[model samples]
Each structure stands twice: as C-alpha cells, then as structure tokens.
Target: MKKKVSLGFKLPAGMKPPEAFELVSSEGADDPAAYLAHLEDSQVEGIVTGMGRRFDVSLISKLPARIKIIATASVGFDHIDVKAAAARGIAVTNTPDVLTDATADMTMLLILNVSRRMREYLELMKEGWGKSLGFEGMLGFDPAGKYLGIVGMGRIGQAVAARARAFGINIAYHNRHRLPPEKEGDAHYFSSLEEMLPHCKILSLNAPATAETKELLNKRTIALLPKGAIVVNVARGDLINEEDLIEALANGHLGGAGLDVFKNEPHFNRRLAEFPNVFLTPHAASATVETRTGIAKRAFENVARVLSGEAPRDLVQAP
Candidate 1:
C-alpha cells in the first residue's frame, strides 16, 4: 500500500498548484470535487495550506480523525483557531522568523511611499520629465527625527524600529507590557494608543488580526492621530477600516497610507486603489523567494515532526 498525505491547501489566486503534493490538487485540475472526497479516504494523514479564512474555526473540529497536524504557510497564524487544535491534541505550526527581515523592509518601503508620495510623483514622470515650474515638485517628508508609533512590538516591529533608529527616527510603542528601558533602549513606551497617537508622525499597526483588533482604526481612533500623519499596515487586513482610511486621506485629515495587506484581499478596495496618496500591494510583505521557500520548509518540517511523534520545533501548541 502506498502512504498518502491529504492536504487542504488554498491555491494562490492564479498560480498552478505546486508539484510538492502526491495526492494531486484540485487547483487547475479537471475535477474540483475529487479533492473534497479525501474525507472518505483512509490513507490521508496530514494537511497543509496557505494563509486564508476558508478553513473556519469550526471546520477544524470536523477534520478526519486521522489528521494529526495542520500547518499554515504563513508567518501569521491568526486565521487558524489555535485553541481548537490544541484541544484535539492536533498540533498547529506557522512559518516565522524567516520573513522578519523582508517584512521589515516592506515597512520602510511603505514609509517612503506614504511620506513622500511616490505614486503621485511617478505620475509626474509619465507626464514628461523635467517640466518643473516651482521648487516644490513632489514633497515627501524625511524620516529623520520623526516620531514612530508601533502598535505591536513583536519581531517584525522590532526590526522596523531598528532601521528607523539608523535614520534618527524617535520610536515609541504600545504593548500589553513594557520592555525594560535597557532592552527598549532609546524607544519609548506608551500605555495607551491615545497617549501615543498624538505624538507620532507615522503610526504603524503591526498587530495580528483578532476579534478585538478588527476595524481598530475606525474614525474615532484615526482622530487621535496628529494631523498630516502618515500610516502603515503590513499586518493582518482586518486591523483597519478601509472606508475610514480613505475618507481621512481624501479629506486631508491624514497625510497618506501604505498598505501591503487589505481587509478584502484579491478583491481590493477600489477607492483606496485609486488614491494617489495611498500605496498598495497584494499582500507581498513576505513574498521573497528565499522567505517563501523557508516558510514552506518550516511548514513541512513541522508536519514531519508531528508524524514522528516528536514535538515540532516551532509548535504553537503543546502535544
């Protein structure tokens, strides 16, 4: 008998399924129903997938009894219900650390795009080069000595703050607990978003998406930020109110925004996409080949560890 693994992978929007799986994927295949029939197959033991909301929390309970591990190929695992998997004695793992640097780099890129109006400036280029009437062509602010408010002080946030330090940006953060001054060093800590927002020129929302964090940047919270302040989000899409953000930028309440992720992905917010002050991406914060390969390797390694009856090195739950 041949050993087979059943994986519930969410295919990339236009990508043909990878050659990694043996059971064959429904993506681009003639019969999509063939993939769903795995529930009745007895040989399938493992599952793997992309980052998405499809496999809802309740679905984990209905998984085949033979399924022992669920691995997600993303640095963020907020989509998976960790506690549910923990209760079933099924381990959950996520790809992390590998994307820390790439994501941090995107943060800097956003900062430049939002502060300096990169998209609008490019329009000037297309209209014909060197046609300047005044000294003020496309004014994007410099990062030096500006105050940056980081919502989540995790690994990626820390990496962004580190780079900001080199550019002489004054860094502050709002976290559940404060890191010691020696560890935080030059970066200051604010107990609340209110206290932090007023002083920041660039406010970054880097927290994972959750029930409490959804639509966190609504009108009320946006009002707390200083006038003409830039904003950035490379985290989960649900963290901000897209409609509210657009209005802010259009009304001149905010300077601009840079986003790598959005609330409704693939089907992006048409309004935000049209705004010249808004720089948008299709969630490529960790899109580098080296980073993606590492993510895949970590996800695979975690599954192998669970199958071997040894705890995964990056286990999010106990066995």
Candidate 2:
C-alpha cells in the first residue's frame, strides 16, 4: 500500500508526483488553522512544504501522531523548528546543495545590478528617456579590482566567489570554520568580520538566519564598513537590520544595496522602494526552473526514503 502524504504547495511546472505515495493537496497550508484541519482529516504520513508555512513549536506540538516527516523544499530551515520536530520523533529535512548555484547566481546578479545602478537605469527607460546625461550624471562602480567580503563561506558563498573572480573582483570571506585550501582557492580569509568590513568595497551576505546571525548588520556593524560601500544580500533577510540599513542609505554612508530577501518578505518595508540606490526582488534567489525542480525532488526523496523505513540522506537530525 502507498503511504499517505500531504502536499502543502503545488509542485513546480512540469514536475510529477512521487510514486508509491498517495498525495493529498493541503491548499492554503499557510493558515495554521486550515493546515491543522487538513491534518485532522487525513492520515498524512509525511508533509512537504515550502518556506511559506511555519512549523514552529506550537504547531509541531499539535501535529497528528501519524506525521513521520516534514520536508521543506528550500535550503534554509529557519521557518521550521527542527528541535521541536525532533522532540516529537518527526524527521525534519531541507533541500540544500541543489540550490547553491542558483542562489549564488542571484547574488552575483544583485552585485552587478547594485554596482552598475541598473535599478535607476531601468526606471529611466520605463519613464521614457529624453534627456542626455553628463559623463558623471549617473555614475556606478565597476566590480573589477574591488574587494568583496562574503560572510558565511559555505557552498553558496564559494560559488559566489567563483563567479565574482570571473568578473575580476577580489574575494574575502569569514566563516565559522575556514575551508580547505582546495575549496578556499585564492579568496582571502578573515577570522573576524569586523576586520574584514573595512576592506570590502562590496559586501555580500550568504549566512543562515540563526540567533547569533539575527541583525548581524545593525548600526554598530554597519559603521565598520567603508564609506560608499555597496551591500548585496541573497541570504535570509533578518541578517540585516532594515532600520539601520535605511539610516545608512539615507545618510549616504552606503553607496547602494541589492536584496532578494526581506525580513517581513512580500510585505517588505516600503521605505526601501523609495531609494533610487536600493534594488529589490521578492525573495526569489532560488526560483530558477532547474533549481526549484531539484529542490522539490530532494524534498520528495527525503519523504519517500523515511516512509520506506530507510534513513533520509538530507535529514536535519535523527529523531
């Protein structure tokens, strides 16, 4: 007999449901009440969700005993409470590695867009460009020869370094642990973030959202960066303090910023849009067709493995 599964979100285009499982669509799973109701009426042995839903301690505590796993189709698991799920003897897993290149590509896109002021240029084109500009009218920096400081030199960070190197940018990074020489390449490593900031003409955040990383770039830390430095983030939004970043941008401490994620997401701060130097996307760093499909496949594989009494390769922790 096929194991029952609850699908919290629609699959990506051209994707097929996994075999050996009876899938139930749990529409509007973003709503806790609706999701709980769906669970109450179904014997869902596993659940597959995206970051849109939160599986916090409160919700995990109330999950039906039949839930064997919670698999998220995104690399980051900040939305789910892993410890809470583990305590309940439920396996928690996230799709990583597959989205690394896509996310890193998005980071490079942000860096190029912000440094070249593409946001303002695009706006100008939309408004019907009639006026000619002086040579320095809308000057933007070139990435070449500039130092790029990357926080969290993980898979995505290393990928960003490879891409940035192709653009002739110097790479510097800080991480919990230094990468081996082969993976480290020519990128400079910094043991301290504060020491690394002064050299970074461009800064990219690629770290995860954890307690220690929350608001990592607040007023005090933002002051450490060189004047006129550009900021690009393809990581979690909470890694930056929007209020502090806005203040710096308003006061001209920062040259510009490019972001693909926000603290509140879809409901990001309206103040950011007002700035000509700020480029924003609605948290779509890993939205590529190939990446999304790979992520979803990994999530489904994790669910399928656990349901078949085999350990999942990407299990967050043993439950």
TM-score of each: 0.88, 0.97
Residue pairs that clash (backbone atoms under 3 angstroms), model 2:
none
User: Which prediction has the highest TM-score against the true structure?
Assistant: 2
Writing each residue's lDDT as its tens digit, candidate 1 over 1-319 gives 3334555454434444334444433243223234345544535666666765455556777776787877888877776788887888778888878888999999999998788788988877898867674787667789888999999888888899998898889999987778877668889899887888989999888887767778888899999998999899999889998889988989988998999998777677888878788888889988876777677667777777777778887777532
Per-residue alpha-carbon lDDT of candidate 2 for residues 53-167, written as tens digits (9 for 90 to 100): 8888999999999999999998889889898999999999989899999999999999999999999999999999899967779989899999999999999999999999999
Model 1: how far residue 169 lies from native, Å: 1.0
- Local accuracy by lDDT, each model: 0.78, 0.91
Show model 1 residue runs off by greater than 4 Å: 1-3, 6-35, 38-42
